[model samples]
Target: MAAPAATAAPSVPPSLSLPPSQFARIQPHAYLLAHLSPPSASNQPSIRANGRAPSQFRVTSANAGSLTHTNGSAVVRIGDTAAVCGVRAELLHTEDIASWSVSQASSSNKRRRLADLGEKPTEEDEDEDPEDDRAHIEDLNLLVPNISLSTGCAPGFIPGAAPSALAQSLSHQILSLLHSTRLVRADDLRVWYQQPNLGPEEPERHNENEQMDVDAEQSATIEDKPREIKAFWVLHIDIMIISLAGNPFDAAWAAVLAALRDTKLPKAWWDVDNETIVCSDSVSDARKLSLRGLPVASSFGVFEADAAAGWRANVIPDATEQTQTGKKGSPERWILADPDGYEEGLIQERACIVVDKQKDGKTTIVKMEKNGGWTVDTEDLRQLVEISAQRWDEMKRILDQC
Candidate 1:
């Protein structure tokens, strides 16, 4: 008998509901132009959908500790975009955890050695860590975050299928921010417990000046070590896409931050006789998770609209010229905050900034990501910083209230 014929895959991508030609890119300005534009010759928009200015954010609502079963939970809504985040704390045995620094160091060294053999670390592993001392290395696998874009949340998602590329990419970005920013320190999660060394810690040389009986002296030489462990707490962060209007990053991050603020670990104690750990059930005995910094992220979309620029080239502009300059760009360049699904569709560029305020009241940028083939200069960066600073403060207040 001949071998079975191979099955061919579908030609059309599952992500597309209809053929590409059927979709027409319609921006917010297209619908809001009349309402937003000045009555003069310039029909340029000063407002977007629902009367929102470029830098203005949609109304936001947040609720924390909504899930009783979870260690912590929060629901965040920004305009139509919504996200529900739940954090679960689980116990891990010391033997099961590995030092991340050690593994990464070894991996880098091996790559470099391979580079010397035939490849080069400079080319392949420039962004990778060169090497590090493993003696004091700490394990950082304590926190894990997973984002899901369910079929119910979006049109492109398929039920019960492998994670979509968007979900995977978002998850990776979240994990990277957690690691690169050092927002949550491994030292905070570590459960400290020490074991006793029954044998003599020092040399058993005879002491001529000893006064006690031989057996009594030997027994009294040392005390039993305290019961403890060098273990750490593991966090499972699951964020569900409740509703995605746009700007999932900001909504999801808000949910996560709020949920973490609500997290509390049960008080645990070592049971020497049973050789296990025991946790207290009383709520008062619980301890709050140590957080290094409260970081907030904001995303902006840059749309390349054709604004009128006749006055822009002139050395001087009279009243008429200055007046006409306002009408220069139609669908002109606009920097939108918290873009919705429709605006996101027409965006030519995107940028995200994560920041937190220090004890001295100064804002600090933790991480920044830019993508989508947009060009940005120093002035754009400055604007981003200003916007992020305001949003970061607002977020901190909201989390506090929650």
Candidate 2:
């Protein structure tokens, strides 16, 4: 048999395997798209790489008054993103401000005129002249909001480094929203004192025969001295991002809202003898801030299914089915709510809706910010608003419990 025919070497089929994590790391776009747009034969509902539905948000939790040192403090977490916010109240004397006198004079005159007209200032009036209503807060910079994200909260963020551009941008956005919403009332921050009127130099009425009774009667008839602003409580809102997975703005804003709601400034009064403001030490004397409305932020990202279409076309041998279905030319898109870090990296288009639902069952859109893509339209905005309303309800309930 001629050396016993050499047995054909057994052939081993080519094989390769990779863990899900390794696959995601190597092919992020493909990995996400695979979940978002599964094969037609699978008949699976579209979902995100993080195992959440397109419109689903991560669970949120908040805890107020967590820090004892700060006047108001809150810890908030939305999924893996977590933040701590503190509100510290400091007194700013009117005498220290150069423009306080001028602004106070103008404001007093306007108030007197409004009083004379016998018409109380209405929301419509304030809306017509928002700049005037916001003058004190903006001009004085009473509300100082700063966001810190340099504590190695995420990759590329080195601890102890200077604030990154993202941090500055978030700070600006928070400050802008605070001013636009007028969430904190200026009246609550004002510390007023009545001026003592020394009526026309009474010349020391020590003698009983000097018509002391007549002078007393006349003084009683005189109108009360106008109350002047002695000082204002400046709120320094500091937010620190402990962990950032994505959707940082929403977490930051929620922490701010919760902390502000928990904030209670001490009752303060002007001390003439010391020529300074005095704050009550008793806990019972602390007063909480009167926030105008609960404005909640909801952010979404738009991911085009065709982000890697070109790569797929190059890799796949056949394009006949894709061309016939027209999917190759026009791929579908998804609006992902509360996108995580992985999803945020793959998405470019985004929209943020800030809404406040009133006690009267009316929902008000406080602000809407969108950028990067035109895939979202008016109908999409309406749907986002509905989603935001539900989010607002959830946040409200959590905050109330806190």
Task: Give the candidate number with the greatest lDDT.
Answer: 2
Give one digit per residue, the lDDT tens place, for model 1 in 147-183.
9986778776768889878788888887777766665
Whole-model lDDT per candidate: 0.71, 0.87
Question: How does model 2 score by TM-score?
Answer: 0.84
Task: Point to the candidate with the largest TM-score.
Answer: 2
| Residue pairs in collision within model 2 | none
Task: Give the Å shift of residue 134 in candidate 2.
Answer: 1.0
Question: What's model 2's lDDT at 161?
Answer: 83
Q: Which stretches of candidate 1 lie over 4 Å from their true place?
A: 1-29, 32-45, 98-140, 195-230, 306-331
Candidate 2 wrong stretches, greater than 4 Å:
1-14, 111-132, 196-224, 308-330
Number of clashing residue pairs in every model? 11, 0
Q: Relative to the unseen true structure, what is the C-alpha lDDT of residue 277 in candidate 1, on a scale of 0 to 100?
A: 67
Tell how far residue 212 is off in model 1, in angstroms.
10
TM-score of each model, in listed order: 0.70, 0.84
